[model samples]
Target: MMEVPRDLFIPPDALEVFLDTFQGPLDLLLYLIRKHNLEVLDIPMAELTRQYMAYVEIMRANQLELAAEYLLMTALLIEIKSRMLLPRPIIRTNEDDLDPRAELMRRLLEYEQMKLAAQRLNDIPQVERDFTLVQVLIEQTVAKRLPEVNVDDLRNAWITLVVRAQVNRHHRVTRAELSVRSHMSRIMRDLRGREFIEFNELFGPSAGVAEVVVTFLALLELVKESLVEISQSQPIGIIYVKSTDFLTSV
Candidate 1:
């Protein structure tokens, strides 16, 4: 018998031929069937076996280690091809003959379904890949409150001041000169350096009835001239006097 050389089956560029690697024999078989558009249930065993053997030869030539699963599938393909060539029995029965490709077809269909499901799961939105979660922090602040005063409270305070002045009144008659214009100028000078002043604080206990009256008139004249403002809050609260210059600047 003549011996064939081992190198005869291997191509010269076998090292350069890139083999399409697959997960298993079934994966390679499925790829081939799909590429050729062959029917899964009615596989053409002769053509399939020829192509499969050609791939196995390429693997061997490239020095690629063949797995046991690939070898088993190769044997099954050859057996199916050989059985297709043989004649069948003439005995009639209600059930049809079993297809050789039935098991392979079921496995391929299941694998394809699982592959599609995995792909769908991978496409779902992820925390970092698709979008990121955002968080915001805010700083809190404390509120401030200002004191309030009322008109009735100012009237009561004025009455008290007058009573106190009368209690400390002297019987000796003395004509102490007090001018409303001079008091007005003094009040304006006092208010210029300050923002607000309490209304009762403007008078002193030593100031007699004449000085208090003149000072009160001077304050009224300042209000009439729009130079100062008398403001209050509730029914009985501290009264405040503010310069119109401060109010305007604010």
Candidate 2:
């Protein structure tokens, strides 16, 4: 008797197969109807609705989140079923009788068509190509001697630094985020009278350690942009600055 009981044991997780795949109760019902090649307009609501609730029970057994939409769709199906079961006076005419489920059928057909179209589109190849119309042309104008550094040149470099730092990977806490542009503007205002200053001294203690580090990076970018020049006195000494060959075009 004991051996027979052990031998007769059934697999525990057989119901998990159904629960894992269903989007919701409605999706399961729709799938079952389609699999059986049943017309949506003539849905045997009593049978289909029972099957839907069974799928929901399976979902509940698996402790999955039961969305309210599933329950709502079930109620709608039941209502449509009750409406279909009612008696109505037959009108003798050439025009065909209207279906109660016509609206639901139309929606289903449209949705199925869209789904098939999307699948077909996904099969097409994707190609990458540079698509741009506007070309950047650098015009060589008549050489007219002007001041070494303009007010706007330094301002734009500061703007670029702030934008880059905000988007940089190293940033974490927003509270810890310091604006390099804010400090740069302050430094520029302070260095208005002096034409050149030592790079490290320019980023001195008024700005915190993090701000100083970002400012150094900003200076490098400014140099690369030809907005400023960096010069060293010896092998490893303080760097000097001179106005660049090109002023900010932007």
Best by TM-score: 1
What is the RMSD of candidate 1?
A: 15.2
Cα misplacement distance, residue 234 of candidate 1 (Å):
18
TM-score of each: 0.45, 0.38
Candidate 2 lDDT over 16-88, as tens digits, reads 4444455554455667688667877687877776666675665676676667877787787778788778776
List of clashing residue pairs for candidate 2:
none
Error of 2 at 148 (Å): 48
**Which one is best on lDDT?**
1
- After superposition, the stretches of candidate 2 with alpha carbons farther than 4 Å from their true spots are 1-26, 89-97, 127-250
Over all chains combined, what TM-score does candidate 2 have? 0.38
Candidate 1 accuracy as TM-score: 0.45
Number of residue pairs clashing in candidate 1, backbone atoms closer than 3 angstroms, sequence gap of 3 or more or interchain? 1
Error of 1 at 5 (Å): 27
In angstroms, give how far residue 146 of model 1 lies from its true place: 18
